[model samples]
Target: MSGFESNPFADPVDVNPFQDASITQATSGATENVGEFNPFAGTNSGKTIPISAASSQPAVLQTSMEQSAQENAAAGQASLIKQQEELERKAADLERREQELQTGMENNWPPLPSFSPVKPCFYQDFEEDIPEEYHRICKRMYYLWMCIATLFLNVLACLAYFTADSASGVDFGLAILWFVLFTPVSFICWYRPVYKAFRSDSSFSFFFFFFVFFFQVAVYVIQTVGIPRWGNSGWIAAISMIRVNLAVAVVMMVVAGFFTVNAILSVILLKMVHSKYRRTGASFTKAQQEFSSGVLTNRTVQTAATSAASAAAQGAFGRNQEN
Candidate 1:
Protein backbone atom coordinates (compact mmCIF):
# COMPACT_ATOMS: atom_id res chain seq x y z
CA MET A 1 0.00 0.00 0.00
CA SER A 2 2.89 2.22 0.87
CA GLY A 3 4.55 1.57 -2.51
CA PHE A 4 1.29 2.06 -4.51
CA GLU A 5 0.22 5.28 -2.66
CA SER A 6 1.70 8.59 -3.94
CA ASN A 7 3.76 10.38 -1.31
CA PRO A 8 3.35 14.17 -1.03
CA PHE A 9 7.13 14.75 -0.81
CA ALA A 10 7.97 12.38 -3.73
CA ASP A 11 8.74 13.66 -7.37
CA PRO A 12 5.82 13.38 -9.89
CA VAL A 13 6.18 10.81 -12.69
CA ASP A 14 4.59 10.55 -16.28
CA VAL A 15 1.45 8.36 -16.15
CA ASN A 16 0.68 8.03 -19.96
CA PRO A 17 1.38 4.52 -21.15
CA PHE A 18 0.90 5.25 -24.97
CA GLN A 19 3.66 8.02 -25.03
CA ASP A 20 6.66 7.26 -27.43
CA ALA A 21 10.27 8.49 -27.41
CA SER A 22 9.71 10.67 -30.58
CA ILE A 23 6.58 12.27 -29.08
CA THR A 24 8.41 12.85 -25.86
CA GLN A 25 11.32 14.47 -27.74
CA ALA A 26 8.88 16.69 -29.72
CA THR A 27 6.97 17.72 -26.56
CA SER A 28 10.27 18.52 -24.78
CA GLY A 29 11.52 20.58 -27.80
CA ALA A 30 8.22 22.54 -27.85
CA THR A 31 8.49 23.11 -24.11
CA GLU A 32 12.08 24.38 -24.48
CA ASN A 33 10.93 26.83 -27.30
CA VAL A 34 8.11 28.10 -25.11
CA GLY A 35 10.49 28.68 -22.20
CA GLU A 36 12.99 30.67 -24.44
CA PHE A 37 10.29 32.78 -26.22
CA ASN A 38 10.12 36.54 -25.43
CA PRO A 39 6.89 38.41 -26.47
CA PHE A 40 8.65 41.85 -26.79
CA ALA A 41 11.73 40.66 -28.75
CA GLY A 42 12.14 40.96 -32.53
CA THR A 43 11.56 37.85 -34.69
CA ASN A 44 14.58 35.58 -35.36
CA SER A 45 12.99 34.08 -38.54
CA GLY A 46 14.24 35.34 -41.92
CA LYS A 47 10.69 36.77 -42.59
CA THR A 48 9.65 39.51 -40.21
CA ILE A 49 6.06 40.12 -38.97
CA PRO A 50 4.39 43.23 -40.43
CA ILE A 51 3.46 46.15 -38.14
CA SER A 52 1.18 49.18 -38.99
CA ALA A 53 3.33 52.35 -39.26
CA ALA A 54 0.50 54.36 -37.65
CA SER A 55 2.99 56.76 -35.93
CA SER A 56 4.13 58.17 -39.33
CA GLN A 57 0.65 58.06 -40.96
CA PRO A 58 -0.54 61.48 -39.66
CA ALA A 59 2.67 63.22 -40.81
CA VAL A 60 2.48 61.69 -44.34
CA LEU A 61 -1.25 62.47 -44.57
CA GLN A 62 -0.62 66.09 -43.41
CA THR A 63 2.15 66.56 -46.01
CA SER A 64 -0.07 65.17 -48.79
CA MET A 65 -2.99 67.41 -47.75
CA GLU A 66 -0.69 70.49 -47.80
CA GLN A 67 0.62 69.56 -51.27
CA SER A 68 -2.91 68.99 -52.57
CA ALA A 69 -4.08 72.35 -51.14
CA GLN A 70 -1.14 74.14 -52.87
CA GLU A 71 -1.96 72.42 -56.18
CA ASN A 72 -5.63 73.40 -55.96
CA ALA A 73 -4.72 76.99 -55.19
CA ALA A 74 -2.34 77.12 -58.19
CA ALA A 75 -5.05 75.72 -60.49
CA GLY A 76 -7.54 78.34 -59.27
CA GLN A 77 -5.04 81.18 -59.77
CA ALA A 78 -4.21 80.00 -63.29
CA SER A 79 -7.90 79.95 -64.29
CA LEU A 80 -8.43 83.49 -62.97
CA ILE A 81 -5.42 84.79 -64.92
CA LYS A 82 -6.70 83.17 -68.13
CA GLN A 83 -10.17 84.71 -67.72
CA GLN A 84 -8.65 88.16 -67.15
CA GLU A 85 -6.57 87.93 -70.33
CA GLU A 86 -9.65 86.93 -72.38
CA LEU A 87 -11.59 89.94 -71.08
CA GLU A 88 -8.73 92.30 -71.97
CA ARG A 89 -8.59 90.95 -75.52
CA LYS A 90 -12.34 91.40 -76.05
CA ALA A 91 -12.20 94.98 -74.70
CA ALA A 92 -9.35 95.90 -77.08
CA ASP A 93 -11.25 94.42 -80.05
CA LEU A 94 -14.34 96.50 -79.19
CA GLU A 95 -12.26 99.70 -78.91
CA ARG A 96 -10.66 99.00 -82.32
CA ARG A 97 -14.09 98.53 -83.95
CA GLU A 98 -15.38 101.76 -82.38
CA GLN A 99 -12.36 103.67 -83.69
CA GLU A 100 -12.78 102.28 -87.19
CA LEU A 101 -16.50 103.12 -87.22
CA GLN A 102 -15.88 106.69 -86.04
CA THR A 103 -13.15 107.26 -88.64
CA GLY A 104 -15.45 106.03 -91.44
CA MET A 105 -14.51 104.07 -94.58
CA GLU A 106 -14.36 104.35 -98.39
CA ASN A 107 -17.30 105.97 -100.21
CA ASN A 108 -19.25 105.12 -103.39
CA TRP A 109 -21.58 108.05 -103.88
CA PRO A 110 -23.57 109.80 -106.65
CA PRO A 111 -24.50 106.40 -108.11
CA LEU A 112 -24.31 107.54 -111.72
CA PRO A 113 -24.70 105.66 -115.00
CA SER A 114 -21.45 104.78 -116.73
CA PHE A 115 -22.58 106.00 -120.19
CA SER A 116 -23.68 109.45 -118.95
CA PRO A 117 -21.41 112.27 -120.13
CA VAL A 118 -22.02 114.24 -116.92
CA LYS A 119 -19.84 112.85 -114.13
CA PRO A 120 -20.91 113.06 -110.49
CA CYS A 121 -19.13 116.05 -108.99
CA PHE A 122 -19.68 115.12 -105.37
CA TYR A 123 -19.66 112.07 -103.09
CA GLN A 124 -23.16 111.79 -101.62
CA ASP A 125 -23.73 108.38 -99.99
CA PHE A 126 -25.47 108.77 -96.63
CA GLU A 127 -24.78 105.19 -95.49
CA GLU A 128 -21.09 105.16 -96.39
CA ASP A 129 -20.20 108.81 -95.82
CA ILE A 130 -22.30 109.61 -92.70
CA PRO A 131 -22.28 108.05 -89.24
CA GLU A 132 -25.34 106.12 -87.96
CA GLU A 133 -26.14 108.89 -85.50
CA TYR A 134 -26.28 111.48 -88.31
CA HIS A 135 -28.01 109.45 -91.08
CA ARG A 136 -31.60 110.59 -90.49
CA ILE A 137 -30.75 114.29 -90.15
CA CYS A 138 -28.43 114.23 -93.17
CA LYS A 139 -31.09 112.55 -95.33
CA ARG A 140 -33.65 115.12 -94.16
CA MET A 141 -31.31 117.88 -95.37
CA TYR A 142 -31.04 116.23 -98.79
CA TYR A 143 -34.82 115.89 -99.03
CA LEU A 144 -35.15 119.56 -98.11
CA TRP A 145 -32.90 120.47 -101.02
CA MET A 146 -35.08 118.40 -103.37
CA CYS A 147 -38.23 120.05 -102.07
CA ILE A 148 -36.65 123.48 -102.61
CA ALA A 149 -35.70 122.64 -106.19
CA THR A 150 -39.22 121.32 -106.89
CA LEU A 151 -40.71 124.50 -105.43
CA PHE A 152 -38.53 126.55 -107.80
CA LEU A 153 -39.76 124.60 -110.80
CA ASN A 154 -43.35 125.01 -109.67
CA VAL A 155 -42.77 128.76 -109.30
CA LEU A 156 -41.40 128.88 -112.87
CA ALA A 157 -44.46 127.07 -114.22
CA CYS A 158 -46.82 129.36 -112.32
CA LEU A 159 -44.99 132.44 -113.62
CA ALA A 160 -45.18 131.10 -117.21
CA TYR A 161 -48.93 130.59 -116.75
CA PHE A 162 -49.28 134.15 -115.41
CA THR A 163 -47.28 135.57 -118.33
CA ALA A 164 -49.52 133.81 -120.92
CA ASP A 165 -52.28 136.30 -120.02
CA SER A 166 -49.80 139.17 -120.55
CA ALA A 167 -49.64 139.86 -116.80
CA SER A 168 -45.85 140.40 -116.61
CA GLY A 169 -43.20 138.98 -118.96
CA VAL A 170 -40.52 140.38 -116.61
CA ASP A 171 -41.75 138.15 -113.76
CA PHE A 172 -41.73 135.11 -116.07
CA GLY A 173 -38.24 135.88 -117.34
CA LEU A 174 -36.96 136.56 -113.80
CA ALA A 175 -38.52 133.29 -112.52
CA ILE A 176 -36.54 131.35 -115.15
CA LEU A 177 -33.37 133.19 -114.20
CA TRP A 178 -33.99 132.58 -110.47
CA PHE A 179 -34.66 128.89 -111.12
CA VAL A 180 -31.48 128.42 -113.14
CA LEU A 181 -29.25 130.55 -110.96
CA PHE A 182 -30.48 129.71 -107.43
CA THR A 183 -30.93 125.95 -107.86
CA PRO A 184 -27.25 125.22 -108.44
CA VAL A 185 -26.01 128.03 -106.26
CA SER A 186 -28.17 126.97 -103.29
CA PHE A 187 -26.88 123.40 -103.65
CA ILE A 188 -23.25 124.49 -103.72
CA CYS A 189 -23.57 127.02 -100.91
CA TRP A 190 -25.90 125.62 -98.24
CA TYR A 191 -26.70 122.00 -99.14
CA ARG A 192 -23.13 120.96 -99.95
CA PRO A 193 -21.72 122.74 -96.88
CA VAL A 194 -24.20 121.04 -94.52
CA TYR A 195 -23.58 117.71 -96.22
CA LYS A 196 -19.84 118.09 -95.76
CA ALA A 197 -20.38 119.20 -92.14
CA PHE A 198 -22.14 115.90 -91.37
CA ARG A 199 -19.87 113.80 -93.59
CA SER A 200 -16.53 114.92 -92.09
CA ASP A 201 -17.72 116.81 -89.00
CA SER A 202 -16.00 119.79 -90.58
CA SER A 203 -16.16 122.90 -88.37
CA PHE A 204 -15.55 125.24 -91.32
CA SER A 205 -18.32 123.60 -93.32
CA PHE A 206 -20.71 123.92 -90.39
CA PHE A 207 -19.90 127.63 -90.01
CA PHE A 208 -20.26 128.21 -93.74
CA PHE A 209 -23.59 126.36 -93.87
CA PHE A 210 -24.95 128.32 -90.94
CA PHE A 211 -23.91 131.60 -92.55
CA VAL A 212 -25.29 130.76 -96.01
CA PHE A 213 -28.45 128.97 -94.82
CA PHE A 214 -29.39 131.95 -92.64
CA PHE A 215 -29.38 134.14 -95.75
CA GLN A 216 -31.31 131.40 -97.58
CA VAL A 217 -33.93 131.45 -94.82
CA ALA A 218 -34.19 135.20 -95.25
CA VAL A 219 -34.67 134.75 -99.01
CA TYR A 220 -37.38 132.16 -98.37
CA VAL A 221 -39.18 134.66 -96.12
CA ILE A 222 -38.91 137.31 -98.82
CA GLN A 223 -40.26 134.92 -101.43
CA THR A 224 -43.13 133.89 -99.13
CA VAL A 225 -44.11 137.61 -98.77
CA GLY A 226 -44.80 137.73 -102.56
CA ILE A 227 -43.29 141.21 -103.10
CA PRO A 228 -44.78 142.24 -106.43
CA ARG A 229 -42.37 142.40 -109.46
CA TRP A 230 -39.72 140.33 -107.63
CA GLY A 231 -40.46 137.15 -109.69
CA ASN A 232 -42.05 135.34 -106.68
CA SER A 233 -45.79 134.56 -106.85
CA GLY A 234 -46.19 135.00 -103.10
CA TRP A 235 -49.16 136.09 -100.93
CA ILE A 236 -49.20 139.72 -102.10
CA ALA A 237 -48.84 138.81 -105.79
CA ALA A 238 -51.51 136.10 -105.56
CA ILE A 239 -53.88 138.46 -103.69
CA SER A 240 -53.31 141.18 -106.29
CA MET A 241 -54.08 138.75 -109.16
CA ILE A 242 -57.55 138.01 -107.67
CA ARG A 243 -58.74 141.39 -109.12
CA VAL A 244 -57.62 140.41 -112.64
CA ASN A 245 -58.46 136.67 -112.98
CA LEU A 246 -59.79 134.19 -110.37
CA ALA A 247 -58.04 131.20 -112.02
CA VAL A 248 -54.73 133.09 -112.14
CA ALA A 249 -55.18 134.12 -108.50
CA VAL A 250 -55.87 130.49 -107.50
CA VAL A 251 -52.77 129.31 -109.38
CA MET A 252 -50.61 132.08 -107.89
CA MET A 253 -51.98 131.26 -104.41
CA VAL A 254 -50.88 127.64 -104.93
CA VAL A 255 -47.41 128.86 -105.86
CA ALA A 256 -47.46 131.11 -102.78
CA GLY A 257 -48.42 128.09 -100.63
CA PHE A 258 -45.41 126.25 -102.06
CA PHE A 259 -43.16 129.18 -101.19
CA THR A 260 -44.60 129.28 -97.66
CA VAL A 261 -43.82 125.61 -97.29
CA ASN A 262 -40.26 126.24 -98.45
CA ALA A 263 -39.84 129.01 -95.90
CA ILE A 264 -41.16 126.86 -93.03
CA LEU A 265 -38.92 123.96 -94.09
CA SER A 266 -35.87 126.21 -94.26
CA VAL A 267 -36.41 127.44 -90.68
CA ILE A 268 -36.96 123.91 -89.38
CA LEU A 269 -33.92 122.55 -91.24
CA LEU A 270 -31.75 125.36 -89.90
CA LYS A 271 -32.72 124.47 -86.33
CA MET A 272 -32.08 120.78 -86.97
CA VAL A 273 -28.65 121.48 -88.45
CA HIS A 274 -27.76 123.73 -85.53
CA SER A 275 -28.72 121.03 -83.01
CA LYS A 276 -26.57 118.54 -84.90
CA TYR A 277 -23.68 120.98 -85.03
CA ARG A 278 -23.83 121.44 -81.26
CA ARG A 279 -23.21 117.72 -80.75
CA THR A 280 -20.32 117.53 -83.27
CA GLY A 281 -17.54 118.70 -80.88
CA ALA A 282 -16.68 121.49 -83.31
CA SER A 283 -15.36 124.89 -82.21
CA PHE A 284 -14.48 128.24 -83.78
CA THR A 285 -10.81 127.74 -82.90
CA LYS A 286 -10.74 124.33 -84.53
CA ALA A 287 -12.41 125.80 -87.62
CA GLN A 288 -9.83 128.54 -87.76
CA GLN A 289 -6.98 126.03 -87.43
CA GLU A 290 -8.50 123.86 -90.16
CA PHE A 291 -8.92 126.88 -92.45
CA SER A 292 -5.36 127.98 -91.82
CA SER A 293 -3.99 124.51 -92.48
CA GLY A 294 -6.12 124.12 -95.62
CA VAL A 295 -5.05 127.48 -96.98
CA LEU A 296 -1.38 126.82 -96.19
CA THR A 297 -1.52 123.42 -97.87
CA ASN A 298 -3.36 124.58 -101.00
CA ARG A 299 -1.18 124.86 -104.10
CA THR A 300 -3.32 127.63 -105.59
CA VAL A 301 -3.36 129.65 -102.36
CA GLN A 302 0.38 129.11 -101.85
CA THR A 303 1.14 130.22 -105.40
CA ALA A 304 -1.03 133.29 -105.04
CA ALA A 305 0.51 134.13 -101.68
CA THR A 306 4.03 133.72 -103.08
CA SER A 307 3.22 135.98 -106.06
CA ALA A 308 1.69 138.59 -103.75
CA ALA A 309 4.73 138.45 -101.47
CA SER A 310 7.08 138.84 -104.43
CA ALA A 311 5.11 141.82 -105.70
CA ALA A 312 5.05 143.44 -102.26
CA ALA A 313 8.77 142.84 -101.79
CA GLN A 314 9.53 144.36 -105.20
CA GLY A 315 7.35 147.36 -104.38
CA ALA A 316 9.07 147.82 -101.02
CA PHE A 317 12.52 147.65 -102.69
CA GLY A 318 11.43 150.19 -105.29
CA ARG A 319 10.19 152.51 -102.52
CA ASN A 320 13.48 152.07 -100.65
CA GLN A 321 15.47 152.91 -103.81
CA GLU A 322 13.36 156.02 -104.33
CA ASN A 323 13.98 157.01 -100.71
Candidate 2:
Protein backbone atom coordinates (compact mmCIF):
# COMPACT_ATOMS: atom_id res chain seq x y z
CA MET A 1 0.00 0.00 0.00
CA SER A 2 2.85 2.40 0.88
CA GLY A 3 4.67 1.71 -2.45
CA PHE A 4 1.51 2.18 -4.61
CA GLU A 5 0.63 5.43 -2.76
CA SER A 6 4.15 6.68 -3.36
CA ASN A 7 4.01 5.85 -7.15
CA PRO A 8 0.64 7.74 -7.51
CA PHE A 9 2.12 10.76 -5.76
CA ALA A 10 5.08 10.85 -8.26
CA ASP A 11 3.48 12.31 -11.59
CA PRO A 12 5.08 12.63 -15.08
CA VAL A 13 5.16 15.97 -17.01
CA ASP A 14 1.81 16.94 -18.91
CA VAL A 15 2.46 17.82 -22.64
CA ASN A 16 0.38 20.73 -24.14
CA PRO A 17 -0.72 20.62 -27.90
CA PHE A 18 -0.20 24.44 -28.30
CA GLN A 19 3.38 24.32 -26.88
CA ASP A 20 6.25 25.53 -29.24
CA ALA A 21 7.85 22.18 -30.28
CA SER A 22 11.02 24.03 -31.42
CA ILE A 23 11.57 25.62 -27.98
CA THR A 24 11.03 22.24 -26.35
CA GLN A 25 13.25 20.43 -28.97
CA ALA A 26 15.75 23.35 -29.35
CA THR A 27 18.76 21.16 -28.60
CA SER A 28 17.94 18.60 -31.43
CA GLY A 29 16.48 21.17 -33.97
CA ALA A 30 18.96 24.03 -33.54
CA THR A 31 21.12 22.94 -36.55
CA GLU A 32 18.17 22.52 -38.93
CA ASN A 33 16.69 25.92 -37.87
CA VAL A 34 19.94 27.65 -38.78
CA GLY A 35 19.40 26.96 -42.50
CA GLU A 36 15.61 27.55 -42.31
CA PHE A 37 16.18 31.03 -40.82
CA ASN A 38 18.74 31.90 -43.54
CA PRO A 39 17.31 34.07 -46.42
CA PHE A 40 19.09 32.04 -49.23
CA ALA A 41 18.28 28.61 -47.67
CA GLY A 42 17.86 26.81 -51.12
CA THR A 43 21.32 28.00 -52.43
CA ASN A 44 24.64 26.80 -51.01
CA SER A 45 26.89 29.32 -49.21
CA GLY A 46 30.23 30.02 -50.99
CA LYS A 47 32.07 26.69 -51.52
CA THR A 48 29.59 24.77 -49.33
CA ILE A 49 28.47 21.22 -50.38
CA PRO A 50 25.32 19.21 -49.62
CA ILE A 51 25.84 16.58 -46.92
CA SER A 52 23.30 14.19 -48.57
CA ALA A 53 21.62 13.81 -52.02
CA ALA A 54 18.12 14.08 -50.35
CA SER A 55 18.98 17.67 -49.40
CA SER A 56 19.37 18.53 -53.14
CA GLN A 57 16.17 16.69 -54.21
CA PRO A 58 14.06 19.94 -54.40
CA ALA A 59 16.66 21.65 -56.67
CA VAL A 60 16.92 18.56 -58.91
CA LEU A 61 13.06 18.47 -59.20
CA GLN A 62 13.04 22.21 -60.17
CA THR A 63 15.65 21.51 -62.90
CA SER A 64 13.61 18.62 -64.22
CA MET A 65 10.50 20.89 -64.46
CA GLU A 66 12.46 23.57 -66.41
CA GLN A 67 13.85 20.97 -68.85
CA SER A 68 10.35 19.50 -69.40
CA ALA A 69 8.98 23.04 -70.17
CA GLN A 70 11.71 23.66 -72.79
CA GLU A 71 11.14 20.27 -74.45
CA ASN A 72 7.37 20.91 -74.57
CA ALA A 73 7.91 24.34 -76.17
CA ALA A 74 10.23 22.87 -78.84
CA ALA A 75 7.79 20.00 -79.58
CA GLY A 76 4.93 22.52 -79.96
CA GLN A 77 6.99 24.49 -82.52
CA ALA A 78 7.73 21.30 -84.49
CA SER A 79 4.00 20.43 -84.54
CA LEU A 80 3.15 23.94 -85.83
CA ILE A 81 5.72 23.57 -88.65
CA LYS A 82 4.27 20.20 -89.69
CA GLN A 83 0.76 21.68 -89.75
CA GLN A 84 1.94 24.59 -91.97
CA GLU A 85 3.54 22.17 -94.47
CA GLU A 86 0.32 20.11 -94.70
CA LEU A 87 -1.76 23.24 -95.46
CA GLU A 88 0.70 24.29 -98.22
CA ARG A 89 0.45 20.85 -99.83
CA LYS A 90 -3.38 21.06 -99.92
CA ALA A 91 -3.21 24.57 -101.41
CA ALA A 92 -0.85 23.41 -104.16
CA ASP A 93 -3.18 20.52 -105.12
CA LEU A 94 -6.16 22.90 -105.36
CA GLU A 95 -4.20 25.30 -107.59
CA ARG A 96 -3.12 22.47 -109.90
CA ARG A 97 -6.75 21.23 -110.28
CA GLU A 98 -7.95 24.77 -111.04
CA GLN A 99 -5.45 25.05 -113.95
CA GLU A 100 -6.54 21.73 -115.45
CA LEU A 101 -10.25 22.75 -115.64
CA GLN A 102 -9.49 26.11 -117.34
CA THR A 103 -8.55 24.29 -120.55
CA GLY A 104 -11.65 22.87 -122.41
CA MET A 105 -11.02 19.11 -121.99
CA GLU A 106 -14.31 17.28 -121.57
CA ASN A 107 -14.50 14.35 -124.04
CA ASN A 108 -17.44 14.70 -126.53
CA TRP A 109 -18.05 15.63 -130.20
CA PRO A 110 -19.86 18.70 -131.60
CA PRO A 111 -23.59 18.42 -132.45
CA LEU A 112 -24.16 16.77 -135.85
CA PRO A 113 -26.40 17.52 -138.90
CA SER A 114 -26.15 21.28 -138.47
CA PHE A 115 -27.97 23.10 -141.31
CA SER A 116 -25.93 26.32 -141.12
CA PRO A 117 -23.42 26.48 -143.97
CA VAL A 118 -20.94 28.58 -141.96
CA LYS A 119 -20.15 25.53 -139.77
CA PRO A 120 -18.08 22.68 -141.20
CA CYS A 121 -20.29 19.62 -141.87
CA PHE A 122 -19.80 16.13 -143.33
CA TYR A 123 -21.27 17.31 -146.66
CA GLN A 124 -19.01 19.64 -148.65
CA ASP A 125 -18.87 21.32 -152.10
CA PHE A 126 -15.69 21.17 -154.23
CA GLU A 127 -17.13 21.23 -157.76
CA GLU A 128 -15.04 24.40 -158.28
CA ASP A 129 -11.74 22.55 -157.78
CA ILE A 130 -12.70 19.70 -160.18
CA PRO A 131 -11.83 20.38 -163.85
CA GLU A 132 -14.73 21.70 -165.92
CA GLU A 133 -14.71 18.59 -168.08
CA TYR A 134 -14.91 16.27 -165.07
CA HIS A 135 -17.70 18.38 -163.49
CA ARG A 136 -19.69 18.28 -166.73
CA ILE A 137 -19.31 14.51 -166.80
CA CYS A 138 -20.42 14.30 -163.13
CA LYS A 139 -23.50 16.44 -163.89
CA ARG A 140 -24.35 14.26 -166.89
CA MET A 141 -24.02 11.15 -164.75
CA TYR A 142 -26.21 12.70 -162.07
CA TYR A 143 -28.97 13.46 -164.56
CA LEU A 144 -28.78 9.94 -165.97
CA TRP A 145 -29.20 8.48 -162.41
CA MET A 146 -32.19 10.76 -161.86
CA CYS A 147 -33.85 9.62 -165.14
CA ILE A 148 -33.22 5.94 -164.47
CA ALA A 149 -34.52 6.23 -160.85
CA THR A 150 -37.66 8.02 -162.08
CA LEU A 151 -38.40 5.42 -164.83
CA PHE A 152 -38.04 2.41 -162.51
CA LEU A 153 -40.08 4.11 -159.78
CA ASN A 154 -42.88 4.78 -162.27
CA VAL A 155 -42.85 1.15 -163.38
CA LEU A 156 -42.96 0.08 -159.69
CA ALA A 157 -45.96 2.38 -159.10
CA CYS A 158 -47.75 0.85 -162.12
CA LEU A 159 -47.23 -2.71 -160.78
CA ALA A 160 -48.39 -1.80 -157.25
CA TYR A 161 -51.52 -0.23 -158.76
CA PHE A 162 -52.41 -3.32 -160.82
CA THR A 163 -51.60 -6.06 -158.20
CA ALA A 164 -53.75 -6.85 -155.11
CA ASP A 165 -51.05 -8.80 -153.21
CA SER A 166 -49.55 -6.96 -150.21
CA ALA A 167 -46.07 -7.57 -151.68
CA SER A 168 -47.29 -6.22 -155.05
CA GLY A 169 -48.98 -3.19 -153.45
CA VAL A 170 -45.73 -1.43 -152.48
CA ASP A 171 -46.60 2.25 -151.91
CA PHE A 172 -47.20 3.05 -155.59
CA GLY A 173 -48.59 6.49 -154.81
CA LEU A 174 -45.48 7.39 -152.78
CA ALA A 175 -43.20 6.19 -155.62
CA ILE A 176 -45.15 8.15 -158.24
CA LEU A 177 -45.13 11.22 -156.01
CA TRP A 178 -41.36 10.89 -155.46
CA PHE A 179 -40.79 10.52 -159.22
CA VAL A 180 -42.82 13.67 -159.85
CA LEU A 181 -41.20 15.55 -156.97
CA PHE A 182 -37.50 14.54 -157.10
CA THR A 183 -36.81 14.46 -160.89
CA PRO A 184 -37.00 18.28 -161.01
CA VAL A 185 -35.79 18.64 -157.42
CA SER A 186 -32.49 16.88 -158.24
CA PHE A 187 -31.82 19.35 -161.07
CA ILE A 188 -32.82 22.37 -158.94
CA CYS A 189 -30.64 21.28 -156.01
CA TRP A 190 -27.43 21.14 -158.07
CA TYR A 191 -28.23 23.48 -161.00
CA ARG A 192 -28.88 26.70 -159.04
CA PRO A 193 -26.15 25.87 -156.49
CA VAL A 194 -23.53 25.43 -159.25
CA TYR A 195 -24.90 28.47 -161.07
CA LYS A 196 -24.31 30.61 -157.95
CA ALA A 197 -20.77 29.19 -157.69
CA PHE A 198 -20.07 30.02 -161.38
CA ARG A 199 -21.81 33.41 -161.38
CA SER A 200 -20.88 34.93 -158.01
CA ASP A 201 -18.21 32.64 -156.53
CA SER A 202 -20.46 32.37 -153.47
CA SER A 203 -18.70 30.91 -150.43
CA PHE A 204 -21.94 29.35 -149.15
CA SER A 205 -22.56 26.51 -151.61
CA PHE A 206 -23.08 24.23 -148.56
CA PHE A 207 -26.20 26.13 -147.49
CA PHE A 208 -27.94 25.62 -150.84
CA PHE A 209 -26.77 22.00 -151.22
CA PHE A 210 -28.34 20.90 -147.89
CA PHE A 211 -31.46 23.01 -148.50
CA VAL A 212 -32.03 21.37 -151.91
CA PHE A 213 -31.10 17.89 -150.63
CA PHE A 214 -34.23 18.14 -148.45
CA PHE A 215 -36.33 17.40 -151.57
CA GLN A 216 -34.13 14.56 -152.85
CA VAL A 217 -34.58 12.85 -149.45
CA ALA A 218 -38.21 12.07 -150.27
CA VAL A 219 -37.06 10.05 -153.32
CA TYR A 220 -35.05 7.77 -150.99
CA VAL A 221 -38.09 7.04 -148.80
CA ILE A 222 -40.36 6.47 -151.83
CA GLN A 223 -37.91 4.21 -153.68
CA THR A 224 -37.43 2.02 -150.59
CA VAL A 225 -41.17 1.02 -150.58
CA GLY A 226 -41.77 0.69 -154.34
CA ILE A 227 -39.31 -2.08 -155.34
CA PRO A 228 -41.05 -4.87 -153.33
CA ARG A 229 -44.31 -4.42 -155.31
CA TRP A 230 -43.29 -3.26 -158.80
CA GLY A 231 -43.23 -6.32 -161.12
CA ASN A 232 -40.17 -6.75 -163.34
CA SER A 233 -41.48 -5.49 -166.70
CA GLY A 234 -45.33 -6.03 -167.07
CA TRP A 235 -45.10 -9.63 -168.45
CA ILE A 236 -45.84 -12.66 -166.16
CA ALA A 237 -47.04 -10.95 -163.01
CA ALA A 238 -47.93 -12.86 -159.77
CA ILE A 239 -47.15 -12.83 -156.03
CA SER A 240 -45.04 -16.02 -156.51
CA MET A 241 -42.83 -14.15 -159.04
CA ILE A 242 -41.55 -11.83 -156.29
CA ARG A 243 -37.94 -12.66 -157.21
CA VAL A 244 -38.30 -10.98 -160.59
CA ASN A 245 -40.07 -7.97 -159.01
CA LEU A 246 -37.29 -7.84 -156.43
CA ALA A 247 -34.69 -7.73 -159.24
CA VAL A 248 -36.48 -4.75 -160.81
CA ALA A 249 -36.73 -3.14 -157.38
CA VAL A 250 -33.05 -3.84 -156.80
CA VAL A 251 -32.17 -2.06 -160.05
CA MET A 252 -34.42 0.89 -159.08
CA MET A 253 -32.85 0.96 -155.60
CA VAL A 254 -29.39 0.95 -157.17
CA VAL A 255 -30.24 3.96 -159.35
CA ALA A 256 -31.82 5.81 -156.42
CA GLY A 257 -28.81 4.98 -154.26
CA PHE A 258 -26.47 6.44 -156.89
CA PHE A 259 -28.41 9.72 -156.98
CA THR A 260 -28.46 9.99 -153.20
CA VAL A 261 -24.74 9.12 -152.98
CA ASN A 262 -23.93 11.79 -155.57
CA ALA A 263 -25.85 14.44 -153.65
CA ILE A 264 -24.13 13.49 -150.37
CA LEU A 265 -20.68 13.39 -152.03
CA SER A 266 -21.27 16.79 -153.60
CA VAL A 267 -22.07 18.26 -150.18
CA ILE A 268 -18.97 16.64 -148.65
CA LEU A 269 -16.74 18.00 -151.41
CA LEU A 270 -18.24 21.49 -151.04
CA LYS A 271 -17.48 21.48 -147.31
CA MET A 272 -13.85 20.53 -148.04
CA VAL A 273 -13.61 23.47 -150.44
CA HIS A 274 -15.05 25.86 -147.84
CA SER A 275 -12.53 24.65 -145.24
CA LYS A 276 -9.78 25.52 -147.75
CA TYR A 277 -11.40 28.91 -148.32
CA ARG A 278 -11.11 29.78 -144.60
CA ARG A 279 -7.35 29.09 -144.77
CA THR A 280 -6.95 31.15 -147.95
CA GLY A 281 -6.16 34.86 -147.66
CA ALA A 282 -8.87 35.88 -150.14
CA SER A 283 -12.52 34.91 -149.75
CA PHE A 284 -15.20 35.39 -152.42
CA THR A 285 -16.52 38.47 -150.62
CA LYS A 286 -13.08 40.12 -150.44
CA ALA A 287 -12.25 39.19 -154.01
CA GLN A 288 -15.58 40.58 -155.27
CA GLN A 289 -15.11 43.73 -153.23
CA GLU A 290 -11.60 44.25 -154.55
CA PHE A 291 -12.86 43.86 -158.13
CA SER A 292 -15.62 46.40 -157.57
CA SER A 293 -13.30 48.87 -155.78
CA GLY A 294 -10.80 48.83 -158.68
CA VAL A 295 -7.94 47.75 -156.38
CA LEU A 296 -7.22 44.70 -158.55
CA THR A 297 -7.78 46.43 -161.89
CA ASN A 298 -4.91 45.20 -164.16
CA ARG A 299 -2.70 44.98 -161.03
CA THR A 300 -0.64 41.80 -161.06
CA VAL A 301 -0.68 39.95 -157.68
CA GLN A 302 2.91 38.67 -158.29
CA THR A 303 4.48 42.14 -157.81
CA ALA A 304 4.05 42.65 -154.03
CA ALA A 305 5.71 40.91 -151.07
CA THR A 306 3.79 37.89 -149.69
CA SER A 307 2.97 39.39 -146.26
CA ALA A 308 1.51 42.55 -147.79
CA ALA A 309 -0.30 40.47 -150.37
CA SER A 310 -1.75 38.32 -147.61
CA ALA A 311 -2.99 41.36 -145.69
CA ALA A 312 -4.48 42.88 -148.84
CA ALA A 313 -6.02 39.60 -149.96
CA GLN A 314 -7.55 39.07 -146.52
CA GLY A 315 -9.17 42.48 -146.79
CA ALA A 316 -11.11 44.05 -149.71
CA PHE A 317 -7.94 45.43 -151.37
CA GLY A 318 -6.17 42.51 -153.05
CA ARG A 319 -4.43 42.57 -156.43
CA ASN A 320 -5.91 40.05 -158.84
CA GLN A 321 -4.16 38.05 -161.59
CA GLU A 322 -4.16 39.67 -165.03
CA ASN A 323 -5.11 37.40 -167.95
Please give the CA lDDT of all the candidate structures. Answer: 0.81, 0.51
Give one digit per residue, the lDDT tens place, for model 2 in 217-303.
Answer: 444444433344342222223223456456553444444454455545545545554454354343557645644543333345444
Model 2, C-alpha of 121: deviation from truth (Å)? 33
Every candidate's CA RMSD: 15.2, 24.4
Q: By summed lDDT, which 10 consecutive residues of candidate 2 come out lowest?
A: 231-240
Off by over 4 Å in 1: 1-113, 154-158, 161-167, 315-323
Give the top-scoring candidate (TM-score).
1
**What are the clashing pairs of model 1?**
none
**Candidate 1 lowest-lDDT run of ten:** 102-111
